[model samples]
Target: MGSLVASRPVYIPLSPCPRLPAPCSSWYSCSPYCLLQILVTFENLAAWGRCLCAVCPSPTTIVTSGASAVVCVWELGMAKGRPRGLHLKQALYGHTQAVTCLAASVTFSLLGTIVSCAGAHLSLWNVNGQSLASITTAWGPEGAITCCCVIEGPAWDTSHVIITGSQDGMVRVSVSWAE
Candidate 1:
């Protein structure tokens, strides 16, 4: 039998939570991945929970948990031909619960992105970092988004829509673009 080898797992600590009793979780990725967004859930006095968001050329990597929304924007740049440390660009907030799932697409006119929350709400953010609109009953009162995907719509249709799966065992298709 061949021997088994285990590699060390990379550990990256996230920003500290200002207030205690409120847990803070974070996730991030570095260069060569094409995506650099962190999902952080930390409670503050003003906002119960906030998710930082940033838009890049194309999002290729995203780390999320439960209904926690994606938070934090870090731009990975090179200095002296070496990759520099990540810096906080901005913080995005728009969900009450954890972000269950989110996706980006270019198939439609200006869909940009779709974010689903465990609270059964869906939000559309444009490429310019503007919130186009939000829907409270994206799935239904009993629906909790579990997963989602974005793809080109029917061949005859010029626009595209977002497809989602929820805890209610229902698959939903909804418009992504804002008026």
Candidate 2:
């Protein structure tokens, strides 16, 4: 009889830190995913749930969505070439379905501006645990929002447009002028 062999997974290291592409100098460190990477992983409890989408608005902060409708904001950082791990800062609640999309403005004045979409609902938030604005549309099941992007107007102008796409092949445009 032949003996059974156990299989193991291979780990490949990602090295994107050193490579700073061209336009990064004009926009700071956002070229390489805003200079943030999940270099090290800390164990998340079962209650933490599964991350659906994640983004880093700044070096010291990360915003993430899960399989549930709740949104989580985490504090992440490094210390002496070592990962400091993730710290739960806040849990945002409002959506009735899983948040599948997220976008953060890259402008300097609006560094913490975040937009997250779930089902037909869109919400605007700041990294400091504030809900700026929210809107819900009766898009039905086929009109679930699938993607979104933050279009920053100007440093002095608070008015901006939020573009979103849906599963029903329709595009949505929303405007926000609040802080």
Candidate 3:
């Protein structure tokens, strides 16, 4: 009989101050302002990486999911030394399932909203992670929502509407709320 060999899992601790070592230019020690900017940039990069890993639903989609089927937003942009822009901001978690769609109010940029479909029910949330409203369609008959989009009018009379397409070959339009 052959003896069974057991192996225990090994855990490695991540470095607290993990930084890429690059050749220090003359500007590194010469300019105080440059050094400050470098430090700030590094800090932002670290925070951004952590936030991305924490919030993103999947590697492809850089959005995070929350309770009640909500996902938070991150303001991502380009940074110096980086080839592409990066995302920066706080994580918004408030969804119960993977976020199906996201839309920002055109009338008011600050009024960003997210929609997540749970069966035949759809949830609406504001930028601050609050549940502004929810709509439930006819159970089973309505089918699962496949897509959603938000349309806005002029600022004088703004409206928040969610247009959803379901698998049951029905397209439904519901007013999320009025600004």
Best by TM-score: 2
Ranking the candidates on lDDT from highest down gives 2, 1, 3
**TM-score of model 2 vs. true structure:** 0.72
**Candidate 3 lDDT (Cα, 0 to 1):** 0.49
lDDT of 2 by residue, 1-179 (tens): 11223334443433454456654532345333443334555554347567788877667777788688778877775688655667778889877788999888775244347888888889988756578998875458888888998888867777668899998888988888774
Give the range where candidate 2 is weakest over 10 consecutive residues by summed lDDT.
1-10
List, residue by residue over 52-76, the lDDT tens digit for candidate 3. Answer: 2123322222343323343435543
Query: Candidate 3's error at 1, in angstroms?
Result: 49
TM-scores vs. true structure, each candidate? 0.51, 0.72, 0.51
Candidate 1 has a TM-score of: 0.51
Listed per candidate, the RMSD to the true structure in angstroms reads 14.6, 9.5, 15.7
Clashes of 2: 0
- Model 1 poorest ten-residue lDDT run: 39-48
lDDT of each: 0.50, 0.72, 0.49
For candidate 1, give the lDDT of residue 82.
41
Q: Positional deviation of 62 in candidate 2, in angstroms?
A: 1.0
